[model samples]
Target: MATSDLHMQLIAYDYVNDRKTDGGSLAKMASLIRQAREEAAETGALCILLDNGDTFQGTPVSDFLAKHPGTHPHPMVDALNALRYDAVGLGNHDLDYGLDYLGRCLAQFQAPVLCANLKTSALPMIMPHTIFQREVQTASGETISLRLGVVSAMPQLTASWNRHQLAGNADVEPAMPSLVRAVQEVRNQGADVVVALAHMGIATIDEGEDAQNEIVAIAGIPGIDAVVGGHTHLRFPGPDHNGVQGVDSETGLIGRVPTVMPGNSGSDLGVIDLRLHRPENALHPQVVSCTVQLRSVDGETPEDTEIAAVSEMAHDKTRAYLARPVAQLSNPMHSYFALARPSHVPALLAAAKRKAISEAIAGTELERLPLLAAVATPATGGFDGPENFVSLPAGELKRRHVAGLLPYANQVWAVKATGARLSGWLERSALLFNVLRPGDGDQMLVDPQVPGFRYDAIYGLTYEIDPTRAPRFDAAGKAISNEVGRVSDIRWQGKLVDPDQEFLVAVTNHRAGGGGVFRPFDDAEIVVKKAAPLDQALIDYLKNPDCHDIRTAAPWRFTPKLGVSAILHTAPEALEHLGDIPSLHPEPYGTTPEGFARLRLHL
Candidate 1:
């Protein structure tokens, strides 16, 4: 065949088939593959499709695979093999289901699985690199030989998991060295092109610096042509730092070296078109030009029909798994972000944190004092759907719903803080607040209208925040407000709290570790007490409550409207209720009430 007729198209993507439902995006992805294959066939070019990891975990299918080992089939593995993938890299999520399951998936895949980082006591089937040399005859009756070498590497953080099930031997620093050696071996075997199909994140930053020192350090070594990276979910355009576009078969920009990362979850496809040049004087071929293109998955084109079919099957399987009954609720409790501050979910979460912390400090010397304040961060937001309110109908609540609510599976922790320290914590939580500048048109980080992140903690002691006052702490954690936002009206158990006396504070592990935009609490001179899981506490608390109705109690009041003050108090009438048995009133608070918690304003 003529040199111009000989062409190879390399496509890479992270197919997250295990998590998404078959009928949704997964089906769309399958359709995309079919279309690509048809287009490639017409061009008389060989299309080499590759996956850069994250295939195993995320959705109900993964959960089913974990629970019922031999019963549920591996959806991702089957889908990849059906598409006839050229190669796949080992991802961190692949180890989530354990090494045995990963091994099973690898065995089932028809294509070669490449990984230089992962190690196992069991071997022979698992190889570091795979070299493919094929001679294809064109329609004009001319044959051309093409050689390709592919090697892969997983990230170093995979070692944090249980070693017994997944062996992530902590010698990942030697991956680049081994990869260079593998490239030499492939070259010796007459491979024309050497490709490092790495499951590593791209290192380049916009400031013209290689942020990932490891990848940059590896690119400095010789023989590796192109590095297809993953993990960080970043998108790179052309020849990055270290050299020219390495993988370019046409015009070798950046000294004939190219690096690419296609991002994650079938979001986009990384297409690399390379052209090779053969000089009359030299026997070895050189990469001339390399061009990279990003095709978005969310495009207008119709998806692959075959892949879509498989996705539908997987969706059916997932729906069947999620349909199983777990627990019954007596009352319908809605997880409404809008009503959290004025309703009971936040209070319930705070109560759970308080209970968990109280139990943790039961035998400790600090357990005697009354548990004063509890704060809980809403880990799951309604960004995808209804952030304000997620209502559960009166029926059996499946395990999926519970998992959806508390997705992180975080533990609760309690620490003792003085009244001043408690005030500091609240200030940190208020970091979600962004001061409205004049003529700003309401475009701020924290929306001034959204009440979710704005909700304050259910304090055991009464205190007030002057929104008009400036922040007390500067960026360096030093006191800067002078006397602004002072914590006045502070009372615990109807008595003024002493600023010198220490009080126990309840919070979740996420917030304690400086999550929820809170500052790092590691410097606090307080004892750290580990507590029970927050989700379990929520489940238990729900069962133990005499009334499932979420009611607002006294001392918890908010100024809903300006100039017109309203009191939030539990009413005799019950509102919107759901569940098997109506155990509690749905409407807990009254719009207007007399003699509720007093908040005297000085005008």
Candidate 2:
């Protein structure tokens, strides 16, 4: 019994967008971390807490920090510091404000922020990898030193998403090469095990240069013992999501690699346990066995009182900030029929962007081009659950309401686009809808593969979405439909859209920079490449005295599908406003497995 068995525990989570529910509270995670450490101690195993990044910039509190930067430490970093997180990888959103701000915010963290692929002049804040040396007690009551080599990296799209912010400040390398080299270096540094803290998603699809969702491929790289994933905000150990191959959603195993992806927003904790053995003939510490587990904060784990106390001030201020009145709505805002048409929320956003852009270029050369605002439904109940839908009563639009609606802190941007390119953009967005065959009975409206945020609805244009037709573009914006058009009868400013006509479309920086597979946007001529956050722009638009009782123009509609009706599962609250959208012919069909109320839309 001279050589004892070592139990290595790795826990991670991603896309914890912001602290709205108890499910994703860092305080709750703190309690879970403590419980995990206690359990590991009882079993004579080792426990190390690692974060998969996307820590800051999800909530109004984080947004406030970005808007008003100062010497005060970020609330998220404060919580992470108090929790004593061993290390954290960089998430793409971590650089939303800028590289310098990210560095400053990360400075307060007690744990090292690991990101190997990001090559930056600021080396003190970020590095390729790090070796954590710890002592763990064995079952035989013997303590031994263990070296955990951790290499963290993110998708190359960080360069694209944060292009304006990272243009010259930093650059990102291909994750695989950077990861491989780091693994070798850490191994050479007398590391017993190598773990990859990847801020990427588990994707079977080719990731191209971005490598944003390449966790499955990363597991196959040599010298890696385990992986903790993030970015896609998915929960593994559940089911093969979005057609990702080689992943056992039931076991959280991808190609024999033990992995964990705790659902985003502090909702769950991803735990990977590795049983290490030092065989007499073995050259290194071999992981003879591995197990993955997901721990959710579903009224089971209590919130850490201390951690909660530390963030209470931020929480209170954000709550008050969100409650402040900004404007008034003529009608209620909801996303139940956002996919079927340009619903109220998206319509309002587009109107705001249109107004903002029009004002900015009133006398400029760009004013001559037809103006359109491209906006997606933000409050769609996708990752945020059925209750995630935006349902603001016809009253004052509070800051909190905007936070709930806009969600992300994406800045407003305007791009010059040709009619053909705009058609392709809409076609790409149309991919979100499942092809509706004529006379087909109630079918799911949305394609689970396409996220709600990518479903762009261009304002200032009237078009019909023909469900029977194939999308002119795929989810990646490739012209795969081959003349079989999904978007048809497009009219700009009451005239048929000319394919060669030039126009300026308002979009978020996230969209303009190719955050989604919506291509051509990135190549489009930049007009207003930088502006205040979209939500802020909307706020400004609303607060202006000229705007009173705003209403959606309802410029888009679905081509009549006689017997083919689409059903969208949304929050039960949608039932109250079934009368508002007469076009959907909304009827409560039933409830989804996740308890979302299914409303059938007669297209």
- List runs of model 1 lying over 4 Å from the truth: 1-24, 120-127, 136-142, 161-191, 200-224, 232-260, 280-284, 298-314, 325-396, 406-439, 446-542, 545-603
lDDT, each prediction: 0.51, 0.75
**Candidate 1 lowest-lDDT run of ten:** 1-10
What TM-score does model 1 achieve against the real structure? 0.60
Residues 270-328 of candidate 2: C-alpha lDDT, one tens digit per residue: 78888888888866778888888888776566778887777766666665666678898
The total of clashing pairs for model 1 equals 31
Task: State the lDDT of candidate 1 residue by residue for 1-603, as single tens digits.
Answer: 000000000111111211322122443455566666687678666667777676666555555565566644456666677777787776655665556666776777787877776666543356678888766444465677888877777655444322223434333334566677777787787777777766655343221211222454455557776767666554455333333223332332223466556655554566666666657796556777766665555545455555545555555655666665556666555543222133454555666666666667778787786675455434313222222233454677665555455544355666667776777765544434343233333223232223344334645665554333356653223566464542345667777767777787776554554443344355353355346666676666555553433354323332222232221122112233322112221223323233222121211
TM-scores for all candidates?
Answer: 0.60, 0.92
Off by over 4 Å in 2: 1-22, 138-142, 204-211, 240-243, 481-483, 520-524, 545-552
For model 2, give the 10-residue run with minimal summed lDDT. Answer: 1-10
